[model samples]
Target: MRILITAGGTSEKIDDVRAITNHSSGKLGKAIAEAFSAEGATIDYITTKQALHPDNDEATIHLIESTADLAAKLNELMTAHRYTAVIHSMAVSDFTPESSVTIEDLQDTIAAKPDDLALALKEKVRERTEKKISSDTDHLVIVLKKNPKVIQQIKQLQPETILVGFKLLVDVPMIQLLDVAKASMEKNDADFILANDLAEISGEKHHGYLINRHHKVKEAQTKSEIAQLIKQEVLKLEEAK
Candidate 1:
């Protein structure tokens, strides 16, 4: 079976040098990839540049930096190749910078001299429309906007492909976590959803659940166990198909 797995945290650029990203080590995803590869499955592992990836000859690795990059690659790969399943374990950012203003623009707009400040501000606005803003200034403002739900597009892109998604909650009750996980599965049209809580993950024991349309099928107390369970679930999906 051919499988496409995405792991890691996607970043959103705030400026040339600054970005917003989440805390994902890509360990679980990597473990899943390795497990599948060991079973003689072809694995296409797409991950962020910051993620910790595995060194396996059986798996092909593709590195991406931002949510846009991930979306484009997924579109391209889904179109170019036919996969049996796709596991989206990446932590995609919900919001991205709507508009990024350079420090130069802010500096020109709020120049110390009052008379020149107005003229400079007007000129800066006009220049902003004409050219890319420079980032050499001291301060900048980055406006954030909601990003498209990338996972929701998976079923639309490849109707036959088995889709697995992930839901992460920080310090939430078990009931609430399961509720959100179920909602995510329904909304994304996923074959399965892995729900994890940050509070539990931070502890010595990492806990997670694998939920399907019927109910929660498996629970894992460690990262390794989560990876094994994911592999088992994928096998079950293939067998059912």
Candidate 2:
């Protein structure tokens, strides 16, 4: 089957040299892509420059930066090709830097004790003009804005593609994590949602639950195991279609 996969984390620019990003290593995504490669499936891997990637020469690579960049790239590719499946494994940033300013620059507003700190900062923070923020200030304020849900747009753009969404929680209980995953799956129209907790993932002991459209769940421990489980499920997924 032909597939599309996204890995790593998006970096939101604070300045030309400074950014806000996550610690996603993209190891699991690489493992998943490699597993599909072993089955001789045509694949395209979209990832950040810092993330891990497949060694296969057959897989096409698309490097991306911010969440908006990722969304734009996905839109272009999905519109151009009829992919059989889409594995959205990237840890996209939820917020992006809207403005940055120093406390001294907003001294008048701060002294007024505005109740809404973010709103006050947004109204007063100067738009970034320099490549790098000035280091002269002892304190700095950065205002961030929420980003669009890129995964939610995938199935909307290509409804027939088997969409596999991933949900990562810090230390929530399995029940809560699965509940959130199920809700996201429904909202995003994803065929499968891979739910995992950070506390449960360590080295080769990564654990996840693949929750299907029918609410049926499959447990897979380790990245390789998860990839195998997804591979097995993909066959059943196509058969159902």
Candidate 3:
């Protein structure tokens, strides 16, 4: 089987040097990739971090920078290769700035004032102004745009491809969780939706649900275990095809 997976969180640039990013360790995606590779399936991994494939020469790996870049990369790869399944595992940033500004520009704007002073006053002013500028940097706001729905994109590309989506719910009731999962699956056209309790599933431990196309649900534990379940479902679907 050929499986395409994504990992890591995209960093949205706030400035030329600063960015808005999340604390995505990329551990679950890596574990899933490794597990799929161990099963002898070819894997294509797209990630923001410098990633390593389970079998470097055998499996393809692409390092991505932003969500926009990732979307482009996924389209290119999927168009070029026929994948049996696509796993949307990355904790992608939902929002990102349309553009970024630089500190140099701000410095130039502040320094353009027509004032001459002694070297000592200049140093003091520069230091104090720089500090002020740094402190006020948080005020530099950028309008963020939502990223493209990756699962929907893949499903549109290959209607027969087994697409799996992940959802992390927080303190939501079980009924609400299922409703959200179903809606997410329908919206994304996913064959299976993996719903997990975000607070409970941290690090090496995890407990979640695997909701299939028929709305049949199964419990999953740990990242590796979930990957295995996904693999089984994918294989079954492939066989049916």
Candidate 4:
């Protein structure tokens, strides 16, 4: 069996020195990769640079930083190789900095003796051009825009691959969580969806549910247990195929 897994949180640049990202440790994805590798599957572990990964020599690792970087790597790998399954556990950023204005630009405009500082500042809000904003100012405002739904593109890229998605909620009821997970599964055409709550994850004991198309659900209490459950589901998918 061959498997591809994405783990960790994708960072979106806010400025040259700052980014917006999640707190995912990538431990679960790494564990799943190791479990599959132990079962004789070749694993391609694509992860963010900040994610925690295993030192196991059996799995090949690809490191990425930003959401664009992740998307490019995924496109390249999916086009280049065939995999039995894809586990997309990466917490992709929902919003990215649409445009960034440098403090220096506004200062320059202010120094130009414009009648209104507000109008000059508004006029200076041009499209993003530079990779890094100057750090000459003490404060800055960054405009944000919604990022593309990268997970929705997976099935389109590889119609036959088994895709697993994750839906995380914060302090929500189990029923609502399940409903959201089901919706996500349908929308992404994913074979399985892992649903979990942030409140539960913060505790010493973590809990999550694995929901499949057949309405079958498996519960796991720990990251390792969830990894095992995912591996079992992968095997089931392989057998069915």
Candidate 5:
């Protein structure tokens, strides 16, 4: 079977030198790719510049930095190739910088128009985005806008592909984690989702629960095991077909 896998954290640029990103190592994604490769499945890996990747010579790789770049690349690839499955493991940012302004300027606007709070910023505040923000300002306020859910776009592009999503929550209880994962899976129309706890992940100690549309769940304790379980599930599905 042919498969597409995305790994690592996408970086949103704040300036030429700064960015908004996460701590995802992309180890699990690499492991998953290797697992599928060993089974003789074709792999297309989309990832970032710094994340870990599989050394397999046969797997094709695509690089992306920002969320927008990922969307564009996915559009191009998904349209060009017919993938049998897709595993989205990338840690995408939820918000992106809309604008940035000095705290002093914001305060000045509030002071000038004390009566109407919303009108003050709407009329006086001038948003700016320099190639490199000046360090002269003692403080700055950055307005962020919510990003579109990239995972939801996968099934829309390829409805028949076995879409597998990953949900990572930090310090949440098991019940809450699964519930959130289920909701996200249903919303994205994913065939399977792997719910994992950030607090529970540490080297080989990583724990994950893979749940399907029928609510059938399988447990795995490490990145390797997770890859194996996913491969097994996908093979079963391919065989059943």
Candidate 6:
């Protein structure tokens, strides 16, 4: 079997040196990747630095730093490779700065000034923003482009691929989880969704729930245990085929 797993939160740059990101530890995605590797499947991982899975000779890892990069890489791989499954586990940053900074571009401006590069960088960004507004071009508007939500897009590429999406809730009711999972499955076109109360399970050394297409739910406390559940489900799907 071949699988693709996306992990970690994207980092959106704020300036030449600053960025905005998330608190995702990427534990879930890493565990899924490792589990698949252990199952003797070829695994490919896309992740940021927030979570690091032990390197496996059988698996290939690709580092994705930002939301745009994540989308591009996924599209590239999905088009080029035929995988049996794709797991969308990454806590992909929902938003990124519309404008990214390049230190090299600011190098000349900073060199001409005695001031810290931060000021020069800010000025450069401001100039760019003003220039965009002056041009009266909607394309230049400093608004974030929605990154491709992976699960749905992967299903579009290969509908038969066993696509799974992760839905994290906090302190919500069980019924709520089911509802959210159902919506997520439909919205993302996932075969299944792992819904769990991160508040209740995370940092507690405990469990999560797997909500399948049938709307049936099962619980597994440890991430490794959850991996097993995923494995069984994916294998079952393959067998059915």
* Top lDDT prediction, candidate number: 2
Error of 4 at 19 (Å): 0.7
Error of model 6, residue 95, in angstroms: 1.6
Superposed model 1: Cα runs more than 4 Å off: 100-141
**lDDT tens readout by residue for model 3, 132-178:** 22443444424456777666789888887888898878888777888
Q: For candidate 4, write residues 36-89 as lDDT tens digits.
A: 888999888888778888665867889998878888888988998898999999
lDDT of 1 by residue, 133-240 (tens): 565767766557788898977888999998989999999999999999999999999999999999888533679999988985689998888888888888987899
- Looking at candidate 5, the ten consecutive residues that score lowest on lDDT are 121-130
Query: If scored against the real structure, what TM-score would every candidate get?
Result: 0.83, 0.92, 0.79, 0.85, 0.91, 0.78
Q: How much lDDT does each candidate structure score?
A: 0.83, 0.89, 0.74, 0.85, 0.86, 0.75
Quote the lDDT for 61 in model 4. 87
Q: Model 5 reaches what TM-score against the true structure?
A: 0.91
Candidate 3 backbone clash number: 0
Judged by whole-model lDDT over C-alpha atoms, candidate 6 comes out at 0.75
Q: Residue 113 in model 5: shift from native, Å?
A: 6.8
Cα lDDT of candidate 5 equals: 0.86
Higher-lDDT candidate among 2 and 6? 2
lDDT of 4 at 130: 55
Native-structure RMSD, model 2: 2.2
Span of ten consecutive residues with least summed lDDT in model 6: 132-141
Q: Could you arrange the candidates by TM-score from highest to lowest?
A: 2, 5, 4, 1, 3, 6
**Residue pairs with clashing backbones, model 2:** none
Q: Please give the lDDT score at residue 240 for candidate 4.
A: 80
Cand. 4 Cα-lDDT: 0.85
